[model samples]
Target: MKDKQAKWCPELGDFAGPKYRAIVAAMQRDIQSGALPPGTRLPTQRDLAWSLQVNLSTVTEAFREATRLRLITGEVGRGTYVLPGNDAVQLYAIDKGGNHDTIDLSTIVPARAFSSEDLRQSFATLLARDNLSDIMDYPTPDLMQRCRSAIGQFYQPRGFHPRQSDMFPCAGAQAALFAALQWIAKPDLPVLVEELTFPGMKIAARQMGLRLVPVAMDEKGILPADLDRAARASGARTLVISPILQNPTGATMDADRRAAIVALAEKLDLLVIEEDVYGGFTKEPPLSLQLAGRSILVGGLSKLVAPGPRFGFVIPMLEGNEARLPEQNFAIDELVHVTSWMAAPIMLELCCHWIESGEINRHMEWQRQEARTRQSLVRRKLGLPPLGRKPAAPHLWIGAGQDSPFAGLSGDQAAAKARAAGVEIVPASTFCAGRMLSDGIRLCATSPRDRADVTEACKRLRKAWS
Candidate 1:
C-alpha cells in the first residue's frame, strides 16, 4: 500500500488547451485538495504517460511545467516528490517592533532620523499652506506632474535622470514593483529573478501566480551568463534585479557589472525592472539601468526617509525611443492610472512637500551616517572583520557553510535559534526564490533605532549561535 501510494498519478479528466497543461492542472487541483500531500513521491514520467495513455514527451512537458511552478522536486537517487510551496508563508510583512521583549532585526527599515517635534513641525508646515483645501482635493494631472518634476530634480543629482514624460509616482517602492509586474508580466508565466531576492517580491509574485525562475548570482549580484541561460531556458522576458546594496548579501554591482547586465538584457530582449531603493545611501552610485530603453526604474523614500509616508516612483524608459511599441505605451498609461488610483493623495502631498522642502535630504544624510555607525557596532559585537574599502550596506550577512561556525544548521534553524535568544533575524530561505536552500541569515543594523539595541541584539545573536 505504501509503495502504491508513493506512485501517485493525476486523473486527466476533460480539460482545456494541451494535454500536458491538463496534467499540470490536475496535479495542482489534487495538491490543493490534499489528495497529494507534501513529500509524496510522484510516478515516473514514463509510468504516468503509460497510465494516462499519453506520449512520453507530453508527460515530460507536464513535469517541466510542474517543476517551474515549484510544485515538485526531482532528486538523483530518489524520484520526484511534491514540494511544500503551497503551504509557504510570506516573510516580508513585519509587525514592526510589536513585542518589546523581542528585539526585531528581521525587518530592514531605516533608523528613525527625526523626532516627534520634527514631525509636528512638518505637519505644521503643511497645515500652514494657503492651498490647504486644494491639496486635500484629488491630485490633478498638472499637480501630479509637479510632483514628478520635484522627484526628477531629486534624482538628477543622485546619478539617475529620468525623462519627465516617463515617470509615475507610486505609494512606495513595493507598489511601484507590483505596478511594474502588472504592466509587464503575464500571469502564470516565468519571471526571472536573483536566486535570493527581496521577500516582498517573492510574496507579490506568488500572489500574482507567476513562477519565479531563480538566476544564479555572485558577490556582485546576478551573473550575466547565468541570466542569459535562464532567460533562454525559461523563456522569461522580465528580470527584476537590485543592483546596488542588494538585500541579504549586500552585494552592489560595480560599473562594469551593471553595463554587462544591461547589455545582456538588451541581447536577450529582456525587460529589466531595476529596484534602486538603497541607491540614495551610496555617495557615488553607478549609473542606473534606466539608461537602457527596456528598463523600468523603481526608487522609494521608505528606505531613505521613513516608511510612514510610503512614497516612491516608477519610470519606464520608453520616451522618444523608436522601438517603443503601441501596446507598451498603453501598458504605461494603465500603470500610471492604477498607481495613481491606489496611492493616497494626502500622503503623496506630504511626501512631495518633504522632497521639495529639503526635509527628506536631512533625513537621508542622518540615515547615511547612522547606518555606518550601527554597522560598525554590529561588526564589533559579532567579532567580524572591517568592511574596509567595500561600501557598507544597512544589513550584514552571516554565512553558516562548512567553513563557518554554525556549519550544520540551516537558515530556518539559525533563525529559530536567534528567536529563542529573544532576537529576530531573517534567514536566507525567506529570500530564496527557488527550492535551493541557503545556510545563512541576515541582520539589519539600521532596523533598530538605537545603536545600543543593535549592539545588544548582536550580543544575543552571538550567544544564540555559540
Candidate 2:
C-alpha cells in the first residue's frame, strides 16, 4: 500500500512532531491559501489521525483548536466542514470572541467594564419574594410611575423635563420606533432622515410601509435647507434623527445644527422621532431637539446597559397625545409583555444604583477616552483620514480612496471585503433612503474589549485595504 501510494499529504507531513499547534497552523495555512475551499469537508478524526500517523487524541485536540479559531464547524452525526465565506467566518469568530480574546472593531458597545453583580443581587431579592402574580398582572399606574421616575432622572440633566404621565415603557428601541411610526405618520408618507443613518430605522420604515427621504448633510449634520426642501417635496410630516452620536457616522449635532433643524421642523410642522440608543454614553447631556413638543424621544438601556435587559422608555414631547396614542402604539403587546415587565423592577433598581454611585459617569468618561484613543489609532495606523474633526463617539467613518480595495464597489460589496478582511463594518448605503451613494464605511471601536485588540484589528484592516 505504501509503495503504491502517490505521496503523503503535505499538510499531514508538515504538521510533524508532538504538539497539536503544528496541525492548527497547517490547517490555517491551507484555508488561507485556498487549498481548502469553503464547505470542504474535513477529514474524520480517525482517518486524519491514521493519515498523519498521530494518536486520535491529537486529532481531537487539533479539531477543537480549529473550532476555537472558527476555521471549522461540526455537526451531530456528521463531520466538520469549512465555514462558507471567509468574511462570514471572521465575523462569527470576532462576535463570539471572549473578553481575553483579541480586539474586534466590528462591535458597537463601549469597552468599559460593567458590574451587574449588584443588579443580580437585587433581582434575586425580588425573586425571593415570589410575588410573581402581582408583577405579572399587567402594567399598572404604580409601575408606570416607577418606570417614569427611573427614566426621568436620566433625562433631567439633558434638558428633557419629562413627567410621569408623559412616559411609556416598551420592550426596546425597535418596538418604540414601530409604535411611534404607526402613531405619528400615515402610511406612504415620506419620513425624512440623514443620508447616512441607522439601519434599524430603514428596516422599520420599510416594514411599516413608510417611504424614506434622505436629506443631504455636511460636516455638522443634515443640512437644514436640504431637510426643508425634502419635506416640502415629499410632503413628509415626520423627521427621524439621532442628534447625538449619530450612528454609522458618529457625528453629533452641534448647537447651531440642532437649532437649525428645530427651526425647520417648526416651520414645516414636522413631528420628530429621536432615537437615543447611544444617549447615555455622551459626556454631557445631549440637547434634545424635542423643542417642537411634537417630538418623541426613545431611550433604552440596551446600549448603556446589557443588550438582554429588554427594557426601554418613551417620552412624548406633546402633552395629552398619550391618551390619543393607539394601544397598538405599544408594540410589546404582540410579544408576551411578561418577559420585559417582569424584569422591569430590577432594571429600574440598577439604573438607580448606577446613577447614585456615579459609576455611570465614570464609566462613560473611561469609554470616551478609550474611543478617542482607538479613533487616533485608526487614523494613524490605518492610514485613513479622519471622517471629521469632532469628538468621535465609539465609531469612526472612513471614506474609501480611489485606489482603495473597496473603491468602485457598492456598499454591500465593500462590506463583504471588510468581512473577508476579518473586520465588520456598516455600509453607508443602508443609511441612504434614496439612490444616493457614499464611498464611506463605519468602523466601530467600542466592543473590542481592549486597546491591543483594536490595534491588531486595525492593522488587519489596513493590510486588507492595501
Candidate 3:
C-alpha cells in the first residue's frame, strides 16, 4: 500500500543510466519545470520505492545522490524538500566577464610581475627571431632538449636534477598530472591521494576512469600509517602527492615525514607521483620524494610565473637508473601524443627564454615578496596566524576557529557565507575525494591582482562572518 501523504513521484523514463541516477534526473527535471516546486515535500523513501516499483535501497541511493547535488534537503521528522535555489547547479562557476566588484580569492594566480609592454616586447623578440617558423611547427626532439637544459638550470637549486633523456615537456601541470596518471596507473585502478587534494587531480582521475583512494592527512601532510592502511585496504599501487605547499590546505611535508612516506611506499611497492608545482615558493623545501627510485616528479612554472605560458616537465627521478626509462618513456610519450600531440612549441620556447635570461627568477622574486605582503595583510584582517614557510605561500587554509564567523559551519557553508559577502573562496568539498567532509575553505592571497583587493576581500569576509 502507498503512503497517502507522499506527493512527488518522478517519472524516471527519460534518463538512460542507472535507476538511481534516472530518479535524480527525473527529480531535477521536475524541479526545473516547476512541477515539483521548492518546499514541496518529496515522497518517503519507502513510499517512492513502492510507487516506482524500485527497491528501497535504490530510492535511498537516489535520495543520497540528490542530497549530494544539493537538489533537496531532508528534515529530521519531515520528508525531503527541493532546495530554494536549485537552478544554480554548479557550486563553483567561473564568471568569464571578470566582475571587478567581486573579489575572487578562489583561483591561485601570480600577481602581475611584468608590464604589458614587457610581454609585447618578448613576443616581438620571438617574432623577429629567424627560427620563429620552427617554433610554429610541431615540437622537435631538439626543442625538448633545449627546454630540459633550461629547466635543469632553474630547478637545480630547488633539489630537482633529471637527465636530459628522463624529461618530457608538458603543456601545464594538469597535463603533466594526466600524463603521469596514464603512464603509471591503468584505467580503473585505485590511485591513492590526499583526502583533500588538488581539484584538478579529481577531474583528471574522473576523466581517465581511474579510482582515487583518499589517504588521511594532518597539518604536516599525509600520515604514513593512514597511507599504509588505505593502500593495503584498497590495494592501490600508485600515489599522487604534493610534498610542498599542498593545494587547498597549505600542508608541507617535513624531512622526517617525507622519509616515512617514502619508506612506506617502498615497502608497499607503490609508484609515487610527486607534484612539486608550488615547491618554488619555499626558501628551502624538504627533499623531494622523486629522489627515491619509485617516484616520478611533475614540476611546472604556472604558480611562480604567469599561468599563460603553460610549460611543465615530467621527469622520472630514478637516481642514475636508466633501466626503467624505455617502458616508462614509451607510455608517457604515447599518452602525450594521443592527448595533445606535444606541448605548444611557442609557449615552451617563451618559458625557456624567461628561464635562461633570468627573467623568470626576477618574476619569482617579485611574486614571493608580493605573496608575503598579501598574506600578511589577509592574516591581519582575519586575525589568523602566519601561514606556510619564509617566502610565503600564495594560498592559505582558513578553518572555522572558535572566534571565526565560520565557527560551527562546514567548509561549504562557510564558503557560501563568504560568497554572499562578494568574496569567492573554494570550499573543502571541492577538493574532497572520498566521503569525509572537510571543515575549512582555501583562500588564495595572490588571486587578486592588487594587495588592496586582498585586504578588501578579507575585510568583507571577516565582517560578513562577524
Candidate 4:
C-alpha cells in the first residue's frame, strides 16, 4: 500500500466526454461496487497515466475530483489516501449535543474575534515552507530555538526579556505551571498562590501531592506584605502569581506593587513563578517579575491566539542567574517527566508563522478592542462595580455580601440562581485556595458569541443578583 506502483486499475468506462471525468466516474463506481475498498490506494498519477494510456494531468485532475468528493485525502509528502469512511474507519465525528440557550460567563475565550481567513492563510504560509516535513518529526532543538527567538521578540517590546536558552516551548500555561510545580512542591511544603487563583493551579497541586498556601490579596493582586508573611510562616519557597489581569478575579498589580513583590521574593529567597497569561492584551505591560533572575515565567498564545492551539512556553531562569537558594531551583528533568516534552506540532507551527509574520500583534489588538467593547456593554447594562481599570480584561469579580443580591447564598447557590435566570456564571468557590477564599463569582465578558448575547446574559445576571 505504501508503493503506488502496484497499479490500481479501475477499467475506464464509456459515456464520458473528458478522459479525466471518465476516470473519476470509474473511480466512484469501483469504490461504490466494492471492487475497491476504503483505504485502497489509487495508482500514482504517473503510473495511472501509463496504465490508462492517459496524460499525467488527466490522472491528476481525476484524483483532485475524487479528493473533493471526500473519497480521498491528499497529504503533502504522503500520497493521496482513500479517506476511510462509510464502511471504513471514521477519523472523527462531530459532537452534536450541546445546550444553546445558556449564556456562559465562566469560560474565558474570544467570541468570534478570530477570522477563518486568517487561520487558513497562516496554514497556507506554513505549508509553503520547504522544511514542512522537519516539523512533523519531534520538534527539533533548532525549531525550539526558533520559537524562543520568536517568543523573545514578541515579549521584548512589552518588557519581558529572557535569554533564549532560558525559554522552552510547552503545551500551555497549565503545562508549564504543572511541570515547574512537580519540580519544587513537596508534600508538607505547600507552594504559595493567590488565594483566589485559576482552578488549574489547585488541580495541579493536588495531582502533584503538594498543598497550597494561600496568600491574601485585595483589588490589586497578592498583597506584597501578605505574600511575604505567608511564605515565611508556611516555609513555602515558591510563588505562583498572576499579576497581569489575574483570572476569576481580574486583579492587576501596579508597577510599584510588582517591584515590591519581586523584591520581597528576592529578600525571602523565594522562586517567583510569574503567570503572564493575560499580559498580551495590554499595550504597556508593567515590568514583569519574570525580569528577575529567580522568576519562572509561564506564558502562552491561548488568550491572544486561538485557544485550540494550546501553545505555551516556559522560561526557567538559567542556573547561574537564579538565586543561589537550593530549595528554589527547578531542573529540566522534572519538566521532561511532567510533560514528556511533547508540544502540539501543527498549532506550534501556525503560532510561529503568526509571530514571525507579525500577525499576532494585529490579532491581539482586535481581541483587546473586542474584549473592551463587551465589558462596556456589561458595565452599562448591569451598573456593576469596577472590576479593574482595564476594560480589555475578560472577567469581573464580584463579592457576595449580606446586603448584596444573593444575601444568604453561597457562591455555588448564586451560580445556580444565575443559570436558572437564563445565564451562567462561575462561582467564586472554583477559584478559592485554602481558607483565604473569596465569597464571589467571576463573570467572564468574552464567553458569549456576540454583543447581544453578552448583553442578554448581563440582563439575566442583574435579574438574578440585583
Best by TM-score: 1
Clashes of each: 0, 2, 0, 0
From the highest lDDT down, the ranking of the candidates is: 1, 3, 4, 2
Supply candidate 3's per-residue lDDT for 45: 93
| TM-score of every candidate | 0.83, 0.68, 0.80, 0.74
Q: What is the lDDT for 272 in model 4?
A: 72
> Which candidate gets the maximum lDDT versus the true structure?
1
Q: What are the runs in model 2 whose C-alpha is more than 4 Å off?
A: 1-104, 115-137, 283-290, 320-353, 356-359, 384-389, 402-413
Which order, best to worst by TM-score? 1, 3, 4, 2
Candidate 2 local lDDT, 27-75, one digit each (tens): 7887677676454667788887888788899889988877656566554
Regions more than 4 Å wrong, model 1: 1-70, 73-89, 92-98, 284-291, 320-329, 403-405
Residue lDDT tens for model 1, 228-308: 887887777788888888887888887788888878876787777888888888865434433457777887888888888
Q: Which 10 consecutive residues of model 3 have the lowest summed lDDT?
A: 83-92
Instruction: Give me the overall lDDT of model 3.
Output: 0.75
The alpha-carbon lDDT assigned to residue 307 of candidate 3 equals 80
Q: Measured by TM-score, how close is model 3 to the native structure?
A: 0.80
Clashing pairs in 3: none
